[model samples]
Structures are given as C-alpha cells and as structure tokens.
Target: MATVILVRHGRTAANVQGVLAGRTAGVGLDAVGREQARRTAERLSVVPLSGVVSSPLERCRQTSRILVARQEHAPGTQVDAALTECDYGTWQGRSLGDLAAEPLWSVVQTQPSAAVFPGGESLRAMQARAVAAVRRHDAAFEAQHGPGAVWAAVSHGDVIKSVLADALGMHLDLFQRLGVGPASISVVRYGPHRPDVIATNTEFGDLAWLGALGPVADAPVGGGAGHGAPRADEPAARKLAP
Candidate 1:
C-alpha cells in the first residue's frame, strides 16, 4: 500500500578491494561511499519520508543515518535483519577474483536458485527471506503511515537486487542481470491490484512526486486473486542478461 524506496548501502573498502564482505562486521563505508551516501541523501531531502529501515550492518545503518538526517522531519531509522547482506559463508572476505575460480561460482551467476554457499544460505533462500521481509514491512508501514507514505530501506546490493527480482516476479537467476550500484535508489509501490515498480537503481531525479499519497498514477483497482497481475501489454517479466 505504501512505497518502499530501496537504497543500496554506499561503497565500502571491501567493494574497492573486490571482496565478498558478506556479513563480516566492521566493514564501514569507504571515503567514496560516504560521499555517495551524502549525495543520495541530498537527492532525497526534498521528499518526506515516514521512516528509514536499514540492514543491521554498519554500512547500511550509516547510509540510513545520512538520509534520515537530511529529511525535514528526520524520520526515525530502524535496523531490520531481513535487509542484511547475504551470508557468503566460506566465501566471506574472499576476493571475487578468487571466488570466480570456484566451480560453484558459475552456478551462482547462472542458477542461483540451486546454488548454496558452503556453510551458509542459498541465493534462493536469501531472495525468499528478503522478499518476505520487504512485504511484511510494506504492509506494516502502509498500516502505520497510509497508502501514500514513502519510506526507505538501506540494504546490500544483492539483497536489493533480490527484492527487485521478486517485485518484478522474475526468477532469482535473472537477478544478476540487474545491477544495483552503491547508493542507488529503487522505488516500489504495493497496491491492491499489483506491485508497481516506480524506479530502480536511480542516480538522480525529483522525488517530490513520491510524497503524494493515495491512488497511484497508473494500475487498476483490486477485484480478485489476479488483481495484482500486470496489464496484458506489460512484459511478463524483465530480464537484464541472457
């Protein structure tokens, strides 16, 4: 019922070094990341946010802080584990170059639904949980703030991508084709008819339009189970790469 704006956390040292980072603690944003977070915050400052939800990681929390600080009413920030980085398991802290050598790496890229990190969660599991968390929060926030209210969730790149894939109703394997740069913004509004993706991986634009509430610009009202289905002309799904 409400619009949830997904913002991937700013770049980090691990990002610069090309490490998986995973759930490793103390991975704060690098200098470039701090600036990215600030710029993203500034871009969103003109809009009114009901709240800011962040992954329970230093990077996401830091990013959330920057965004909430710039808001007029300064919406409160809360930590949600559902938005945390996908547990990379043994791959944690390993450089992507080295991970690329592993046999499972290709599976991760092409068939994530079947890929499971040794000693950690599968990509499919990550996507499922992340989507569920987002839906749960969307319902809660909509109940609290009303249909037109806007909120933000600061999360990891993969986590946000997975959420996008779910919102688009795409298979998890296709998520890699979707790129989520650090500090990018993706917008989604869950209505009675269907979930509408307003924007994705946004760099810059006027967001004041999102502050408007009640009755989305497009999409029809609800009727039944298929009410959320896209229009006949709408693509069944959006894919990035073959």
Candidate 2:
C-alpha cells in the first residue's frame, strides 16, 4: 500500500476564461497559477516524497516542476500518459457557458457513468484508466521504496474526483459530489484491502505533520504522526482495504 497525494494543476488562462482546455496543446499556467504552484510547493516541501508523476499536459507539467524543485530528494516528475486530461473531443476549447446549454450537460452532472463527450471517451472509461494508472504507480513506488512510501500525481480535476469517488466506494455518477480546485490537494492511502480518503480539495496546510513519523527525519519509525492523525501503516491500512 502507498499514500497518494493527488494535486490538480494551478489555474490556467483557460480556467480563468472558463474554457475547457482539454488536451488543447500549449495551454500553460497563467500568473495566478504560478503563485498557486509556488504556495503548493512550499506546503508540500516538508514531506519526503519518493516520486512525483504528472499528466502529460503542459499545465500539469508546470505545476509538477514547482513541486519537484522544492523537494529535498524527489525524483523528477514522470509524464504519465495515463494521467492526461480527459479527451473531451469536440468539447475541447469550448466555453463552459456554451457547454451548459447542451442537453448532455445534465447527463454529465447527474449520471456521469453515461456521459460520453461527443467524439471522445465515456466517463466510465476515464474513471477506469485514471484509477488503474494511479493504483499502478502507487503500488510500484511502495514496492520499490517500502511500506511507508509516498508520492504525488498532478492531474485534472475530473480525473482526481473520479479516483476519489472510487476510493470512497461511491458510484462514478456520484463523483460530481467531490470537488477539486486548482492547486488543491487530496490524499488517499491505497491498501490491498481498501482505500482511505484522507483529505479533499484543500488549498493550504502545513504538512509538517507528514514528517512526524517513520523514515521521516525528525521523528523515528513507530512514533505517532502528529496533528491528531494515527501513524501511516501500510500493513494496517491493508487490513482495512477490503
């Protein structure tokens, strides 16, 4: 098992303009986005992350760079195709206001399981691939590092939300209930038995508590994790996975 920190890239020009920048190439982070990236980097710097992976999108890559730069010994961000933005097909670069008027918008919101972006993939496809990708990366890192390994994936809002919904054992259609803001952090502890949703859509927090135990420099293994949370135990979390 491993703890996966899911981060949505900072706001982009498209985000500011309410455009669906889906897989539209060259759309980088805007000014506000840079600031969010910097703050997120500073906030996550305390944790000894084993690896950083990101979607193969420029905005996500930009956000990943800021985070990797602040880490003491984090591996450079790996651009995983699995983490790419949902292929919105004809919807790419379209305005949100325009999409809102479309008949399928309601299906997307109320029954995402049935949503298929015109000329693109279905929501169920997006959920399956994103979940598998994150799970694969999480298990691999933990196997290489140890039971207590941690990593982060910088991805799109819907992708992260779908993953969280699965972790919470909620249906894909209910995923809209989960939110992921730009540069926000959502954590999940994936175990052999089940997954735990640690936090969701949080903008800021001093993760000093992350360094409070096991393989963490200041605190020794077996020491309790501070900030009122229990220690992170892979084997123990696995017992709850089912």
Candidate 3:
C-alpha cells in the first residue's frame, strides 16, 4: 500500500481575521502559521517520504517547502491546482461577521448542502474537485513508485477535509463536522480498494511521538472517520464523489 499524508496549510491573516479567502489572491500565512509549518516539518523530516505535492496556493506551497526541507530524503515536490481551496467567489475577502449579517449566512451554517456562494462554487463542487485531486495524487504515486511509497500533500483546510471525507466515503454536506487545524496532518493508505485513513487532525507534537516508534502512527481512531468522529447515521445530501 502507498501512504499519503495530507497536511493543512498554516494559519493565514484571513484565518485570524475570520475572513473568507475563497480563491482570492494575496492571502498568505501569518507568523503563527509559519511556526506551525516549521513544527510539522521538524516532525515529518524523519519519515522516508518519496514525494511531496502541494496546492498552487501560496500558503500550501510554503508549507510544502518547509516539509520538504526538513526531510533528508530530498523528495520531489510539485504544485497542483486541483488541490486549491474552495472558491468562495463573491464571498472572498468578506468577513464572517459581515456575512453573518445577511440571511444567506444562516443558510450556509444550517444548510450548506443547498447554499451556493454567490458567483462562486457550491459545497458539492468543492468536494468533487478535492476528490479528483486526491485520486490523481494516488494514481500518480502508485504508477511511479508502487506500494510502500510515502507521499505528502500540503493544502488548505477545506480541501484537506473534503479529501478526507471522500476517503472515508462520507458525504459533502457533513463537511462542516470535520475540522483540520493549521498544519495538522491526516494520513491515509491506498491499496487495491478504497483508501484507509490512518489519522485525522493530528497535531505536530503527535508526530514526534509517532516518529519515535516508526515512520507512521497506529491505525487512526474511528476507522478513518474524520478526526475520529463517528460516521453520520445519514450521509450528507451531497456526496463526496466526483
């Protein structure tokens, strides 16, 4: 089986300010975010990684750099637009507080499955794109390196969460229930069948404990449910399929 490590980008100014970044440019990691990346790098450096991939977004690219730098393996790192964050469209750069003032905000919080960002993407669309991106990564790595290869992907929170949900066969409307903290690491192993999650929302400090024992941690809790949470009784209205 090939191991895939998914990392959420470090915090950003927008994250701190609680603004929607969507697909807008100019959003980059804040200082705390940088530190988070560095810590993650320090933890993953010991893993025998074969490759590293990142979203074209600046924040994810920067996080990938740090991760690659910490490794002695000198793995290949590439950028892929498929891993980009969800497009907020008109919501880009808008504050949550401001958006909350609108009636649409309630719809997004309660029924995001049906709400679409004005002139932007739907939650369903974001999940589809993220699932495609993850499958591409899996296919490429398996073709080039075969089983036992370990690869890392650096991306945004929403993108990472969506991909994780897809791996677990969860639906997109449940996306809000999953959370990927800054620089958090989620792991999955791919074989002939569906991918299996090793962990989700794992902190950098947890990596050191895992590394001390071996390259990977014990099988994740909840059998790949995002962050160890139980699966929803009813799958979300929006599927994570492409």
**Strongest candidate by lDDT:** 2
TM-score to native of every candidate shown: 0.88, 0.88, 0.82
Better of 2 and 3 by TM-score: 2
Cα deviation of 13, candidate 1, in Å: 1.1
**Candidate 1, residue 239: how far the Cα is off, in Å:** 37
Clash pairs (backbone) in predicted model 1: 148-213, 193-228
Q: Ten consecutive residues with minimal summed lDDT in candidate 1?
A: 223-232
Q: After superposition, how far is residue 72 of candidate 1 from its true place, in Å?
A: 1.0
Q: Against the true structure, candidate 1 has what lDDT?
A: 0.86
Clash count (model 2, backbone only): 3
Q: Which segments of model 2 are wrong by more than 4 Å?
A: 212-242
Candidate 1 Cα errors over 4 Å, as ranges:
217-242
* Candidate 1 C-alpha lDDT tens digits along 1-242: 78999999999999999899999999999899999999999999988998888899999999998898898898877898988988889999899999999999999999988999999998988988888988888888889988877889889999999999988889888999999999999999886767888789998877776764346545545632233334445455632222
Q: Rank the candidates by TM-score, best first.
A: 1, 2, 3
- The 0-to-1 C-alpha lDDT of every candidate, in the order given, reads 0.86, 0.87, 0.78
How does model 2 fare in lDDT?
0.87
* Residue 72 lDDT (model 1): 85
Which tens-of-lDDT digit does each residue in 103-141 have in candidate 3? Answer: 878777666668788888887787788778777787788
Error of 2 at 56 (Å): 0.4
